[model samples]
Target: MINGRDPRIDFFRGLALIFIFWDHVPGNPFAQLTVRNYGFSDAAEIFVFLAGYAAVLAYGRIALRDGFVVACVRILRRAWVLYVVHIFLLTLLMGIVFVANNHVETRDMIQEMGLSYFVRNPQQALADELLLRFKPNLTDPLPLYILLLLALPLILPWMLRRTEYVVGLSVALYLMVPLFGWNLSAYEGGVWYFNPVAWQLLFVLGGACAIRGQRPSAPQPRPLKQQPLFIVCATYVVISGLITLSWKWPGLHEMLIPKAISDLLYPISKTDLSPARLLHFLALAYCAAKLLPTGQAWLNNWPAQQTCRMGRYSLEVFCLSVLLAPLADMANALAGDTWPMQVFTALLGLGLMMLMASGLELNKRLGTPGRVVAV
Candidate 1:
């Protein structure tokens, strides 16, 4: 059976990218309301996790048809393409911003365009971005994806071939968030905005689900007649309520686990990883997967499919937004807290991204959405 693209997943991806862009836009009211804020509930985790999940669903077929070695090589090359795109866009943004801010002599502009200009300064303000010494931060998504892609060889291997290992490791990693807070210092705050070790677990979970034909985590499934949609909605509400109560009644966090595991439930100072937050995230992810998709034919209409198209090309879209984000930030700063301007910036950014991706796809370049071709 052919496992064609699922419109729901694609639409979800597009929605994530939209929120991601809005979240980065200054003064977005939805920023705090969305899941990307404090702890594991952020959009980053969901996106990255889904990325892994999607990779397995789309590329595992190629891996099965080709050889694992060939598949792994292809994945690495694809990752390198992402890295190049990131650098190319970063250079463009930096150059444009610098020129806008100052009167650059022709010679100075040429000199700034040189790769050395961006890479030479060890202590420069953007040294973290250039050297990859620290994570790209909320300033951009490049650094986060870069790390995840870099480590894919190690993680993806087991996930693709060894089903049990993948599930076990994902759980262990998720559990570790509470046992030992994620160490941003270990990665040199290089990937500060996204914690690969902790966040990878979500992707692994998504991957596992996709690999199993989009089944629930467990083998046992209740019949639709018995599994009421109301139950799923209730589960989500109860989880949200608990998360809210935990915040209001700080003491409720203690009740999240047995006394032995209680220590793992609190936030580690100066880091985003905490079991308490992970609990809420897992709950949210579960609820979303259950509630979304009712096998409706019209749900995948042309307009709805566009959202998935946005998602299918999310990395490219997000990269474009990152390049324009600073510009949006500046626009917002100058325009004051105006929602109209924010909306304008978002539309412009997303349009440019779509155009860029269209160009890339036309040329058969990276970021084109399709199944990976095995060597």
Candidate 2:
């Protein structure tokens, strides 16, 4: 059933998880290079973009083999798994806090499970870990992914059943991003750091792209030089240049740039799908795609395919990494600002994650669990 999985998607997803781990670890030698820390190039956009691509690729297969209904069911099932993982992580983090400080007040814990805590304090350090508030803590991505997964079924149906409607809807939604900012605060428990309601359009757009490739609107074949990859790269360059220019040239600000144009470069906060950020991410993705070797020889070689293994079991790896992140943070914190100790601790944390990933890969192949794989 899982025989035809693409190595490219799996490999990149593994890379994304690796970047995510480095980014989330409180203070590590690699944090600065991680997309999370960099202002210009954050991995959030890359992760979301690739997620869109992977969703379409996976759903394309399901839609063809199992029909739309089955695809929808599978998507929902996956989302449910994500939610279960989130709850487990939350409980574990709360336990960590309780164990670390036995005197942690009940009122604080109660506040964490509800909406009031987020409202009372935004960047409160205690709140970030205890409440699992989005953005303020790196652990927030899972909750956001869960929200996105909820919207996947809704968007995927139209994408598979009637693509033109999806196109018009996506365009309308993209345009409206400039007209009205999303009401992030309205989310019941706490807002998803990356609001998928707005981001769904992108993912669905990718699905549509994949669908088109599998079954074209017309039997026309363009030259190899005019491929989608090339177009994507060109578009990325133009968009990125425009964004950079907007930043460099102060005089351009006062010009009659459309509200949509202005919004692209300078995104409003709390919204995840800003056109500027989206384009920036796309550019980076294009570059990565180009650089990554697409050969299948190494992928097919059983013993030499560890990267594929890592990619194939990304969900488990991601869970382990997230679970261990706080401990990594605590270690870094204890190591203090000492450069040598911090470096050593960071390396130790990375080494542990690598071992976990390797062991998980081995266990998965052998059909036995030897030791826990903590990302």
Candidate 3:
């Protein structure tokens, strides 16, 4: 585990990054195995939640020790770095897709990935991109993260003092989104795929969890296990799992569910973070925390340690995954979409990601010796 960092968070974030890679490669067959198939929430939820949790652990501590202004400056500086990385990644992704489109007669990769607007209206799209308004398919999450980081300073102080108020305001904004049709506009006239207004609730919830020292890897009171809330959370998880499995077997689903309940939960709105999705994720998180208590030995083992390493360098790994996704798609196209090909691509892609993480870790270790020698 990274020094002073929670191993569980790193492991989950790394796992989520792997899942995100699989999900991005549509029709890879491995997509069926990711969290989305078993629940209303997907890797996106995990990614955003952990991001908030980490942000608080990192920046909130700075605010508490240093002044709020110093913490705000640091947060804004990090946001600026993410912004720069995003623009660079966007340019590189477009270039890769453009080249891939030229060679292959597959569907226009440009339009399919939502970069056609750049070609059609370069000036406007460029302006929108600079303003963080023009996000393509896989590019949406970064901008959302950057925006959340930018807004962190405004709420960090309040969150430190009156956590309930901050969370309440986040929830209020989330509820208002569906109620009032509120959303930030994208270039070419559409709303963001992961609407920040609704998604911020998870981020803030993560922050609150971190601030209260309630991470999955933290010790909890024994009474928590015996609480009525624990039973409810477990029951909800089981019910949700059954419901998700029904999607795979329609007849079984029909036999199990009443028409009224099915109708009410139909079209589980992911963009809006509907109550069903939110509650399901919360239940899953509760189960995870209960099952994997603080300082679990298994988490420090080989595979989990590698995953944690990846999580420590999430920004680099995530950007690399985004860049690698189209190439994976191209490989899928070339290698025939059989089960074997899908599995091969998934393993190969994930293995490469792990290798990259390991390389980064090695570089850090090797560089340390030189610094020590210099000192």
Candidate 4:
């Protein structure tokens, strides 16, 4: 913990931001290195879960320091800020896509980024945008988060009082998604890219964990290696990694895998947070939580420090990444997607993200002067 706040949260959030940037750039060779290439759930899961975890911790601190009223106001205000950022970011992204498309020769940037609807039907697109349903590629997360935060005021009191009950309710709501086909509408006759109804379970679980940590009466987790659950989680993570990696070698994968299992797992929908994907992410989270000590020496190293900085200024870093992705794609495209350009652009993108983070840290310190900044 740094200043009574968990450094691991920021570290993992920052890592997820890097993965998200690499994953978004079309045809970027670094995409192969991202967690998505070898897992059922990717950076999106980390982003959402940690958003909840950090949000609840922050909210709890505020409620204790001020009151429930102040905490509610802060949460609502945050949702509003995210809403405004989403609007401006969408506008800026659309403009960037147009400019990038005009310059790039390899592919149509508009179609590639799924912005063709906005181009064809500007009026309807604007209407949908106002309603938070016209999100293009790379913009789904913020909108989902806005909805989740908006609902927090309604549930936060209950969550603070009885976290386990709230979590149980969240799980029930998640189950209702598949049964009732619950989802929010999207712009072009489709549902949301990240389904809020199904994804809220992770958000709530993250909050529950935060609440548990703050309660003095809550039981501490058992030593991981001594627990049977640790072995089960470790075994599942390894087996799933192998199964995911098998897709790279189609011939061997086809020969080794049974058709029955493949058929069952074929349509693991990220839209609705499929059970298989959810379970895999849970197992993965369990293993990570158990194995990675929070305050390891390596975590305080220079590289890790920079990542933690990025995590601290995640909103700014995330917006920068959304903008940088298109530019990275254009650079690689103009350079003919050579290995050198791929490596350069990938490294350069991360460097830029770190720079933005560092700048934000300096700004925050200058703004606060002697006041202690919350983690």
Candidate 5:
């Protein structure tokens, strides 16, 4: 029986955090094993979807018990916290990249990481950063998340009362993006990398799913394996796997995927959250849900539990990952991106993240004063 917190959410969120760390380190060999290589979607989808799910689980409960006003205060307060973290993270990342460049004579690090504007025009860049405009690469997701969380005050009430209508509105906004070229403006000129307009659909859907799961009186949804739609999802996952594997084996890929289909899906849009990526993540999520049902005892095993600890402290772990990325890059550049070095860098970075999570867990266990544990 599903009761209290679900371990699966933390498990997957932690796993996504790990993948995000691996993917951020450009030359890491382990990155190829991440979900992005085998599927249309990657850690970003998992992160955002789980964010939405967790938001509902956390703020939704507060709304139910304490009233909408209290929920709004809590949600908006959390958003403010995320905003502050983003600013600090951006400052720290710039510092890291700057120092790394000077030490290694890799001046292009700033430009390569998309922080050149700060170097070229500090005043304007500082202004843009304050306005949440000038986000460097690997930092885009936070602003998008901030916007979504800020909107939760309005979103959560509707989600609890008119779930379909709220989701329908989110989808309508998503469809309008492609039709009307809608997007939130970014630093200097371009649109947000993870366009919130389109991505909100996934976020809202995740929240809806969490709401459904929480209602004990409502009939539980059928298991994915029992559903006819599972066959289609599984088939899509298999085909995507084959297509991605083509990167390793070009000849086999050519034989597996026709040129016409490849051309049609080429440049699968991450900025717009393309349909292929969205559906692929949904399929992967369905399979995960089925395979790891609720309250599975094995989830409490040491490694899984440790990963869950990381998920429990996702914000801290994610901030650490962002900061560690440039350092990892510097290490890779210095040590040479040999297979051994890449593997070592990836392992070491992951170990540090685990260690940080462990420290936070330790804080909670010790009931340290002023240490707020996230739900």
Candidate 6:
């Protein structure tokens, strides 16, 4: 952990960011290998959970040292910055898609991007965009994250005092979503792609973990075989993996997952953060934590170092990823969507993302003149 910022978190975050970029490009073959292929949860879960973990760790310190008011202001300011970036990114995306639509003969980029609304109703679209409602493709997570950060001030104090209570409250709110259809408003009379009411539980759980991490160390953990909870988590992870992989073959999926069980777990909604999805993520996280120690030698390698740099400068890297996704899709489409072209675009995009990360690190080292504080 450099400067009290865990490289493990950054490494995982960077890995998830790469997954998000791949998943954003619809029909990209590389996306078939992402986390979603192995479980009910996807990279978005990791992104939101880590966002909460990082936000609380960064701002909670200010709450202790500078006072709660200062921390609240700082959190709000960061949220506002995210909101602005979302708007600006959306604007650029629309323009890029518009130009690409004309250039790409195989696909209609604007239609694929869900930008038809903006084309038809410019005035209303602009209004909704300002109100945080007009979310096109590849733009959902930022808005979801912005709202999560906005609400941090309210529960953050309670989180510092009693993280359990905050988690309980968050759980209660999440439960109400399925019971009462609670959700935030979105563009064109639809609810948010990511329901904040349901997702807050993950965010809160992440913050709870962060707060717990700040306390003194507990006893050394038991071995994997000796830990019953770890065993259960590991089993669930394996079961979920087989089930998720079975989805690739409909006959196998049906044979492997019986109607009785399928009925029980069907319609697993990412929008509402369904219970099965949540459990799968928690189980996956538990197994990953138990199996992978933070200080492994592999984590110090060249690829890992680049990924860690991408994680350290996550916001900028994420923005570049958002912009790069559709462009990568276009590039592949231009090459007739062949396997070779698909792999090329995917690798090229990752390389560009890594390059941007290294450039940012270099700029920070040369331009900044103070102690490197964790963001």
The regions of model 5 sitting more than 4 angstroms off are 1-3, 217-226, 249-255, 368-375
Per-residue C-alpha lDDT of model 2 across residues 163-223, encoded as one tens digit per residue: 8898788777766655775535422355556665567666666556556545524432774
Model 3 C-alpha lDDT per residue in residues 1-375, reported as the tens digit of each score = 112556788999998998899899868777888999888888988999999999988887788788899999999999999999999999999988888777656567788888889999989999999998888779888999999999999998898888899999999999898789888888767888888999999999988877776423533466765877888998998888879978888899999999999899977888778889999998888788777766958886888888898898899899989988887777767665567877788788888899999999878987885455323
Error of 6 at 226 (Å): 1.7
Clashing pairs in 3: none
Measured against the true structure, the TM-scores of the candidates, in listed sequence, are: 0.72, 0.70, 0.92, 0.94, 0.93, 0.96
**Candidate 5 residue lDDT tens string, 117-157:** 88889999899999888999899889989999988898888
Q: All models: lDDT?
A: 0.61, 0.60, 0.86, 0.88, 0.88, 0.88
Candidate 1, 164-267: lDDT as tens digits = 79789777876675577653442232335456556666667777767766443463377543676646544655655555446656676656645664454434
RMSD of 6: 3.0
Write the residue-wise lDDT of candidate 4 on 1-375 in tens digits: 101567888999999999999999877788898887777888999999999989888987788778889999999999999999999999999999899999998899999898999889999999999999898999999999999999998888888887888898999999998899999989877999899999999999888777765545534467666789888988887777888898899987898779998898878889999987888888988888767775757596899999999999999999999999999999989999888998899899999999999998888777985777677
Candidate order (TM-score): 6, 4, 5, 3, 1, 2
Once fitted onto the true fold, the runs of candidate 4 whose alpha carbons sit more than 4 angstroms away are: 1-3, 215-223, 371-375
- Between candidates 3 and 4, which one is better according to lDDT? 4
Report residue 120 deviation for candidate 4 (angstroms): 0.6
Between candidates 2 and 3, name the one with more favorable TM-score. Answer: 3
Report the C-alpha displacement of residue 291, candidate 1, in angstroms.
Answer: 2.7
List pairs with backbone clashes in candidate 4: none
lDDT of candidate 2 vs native? 0.60
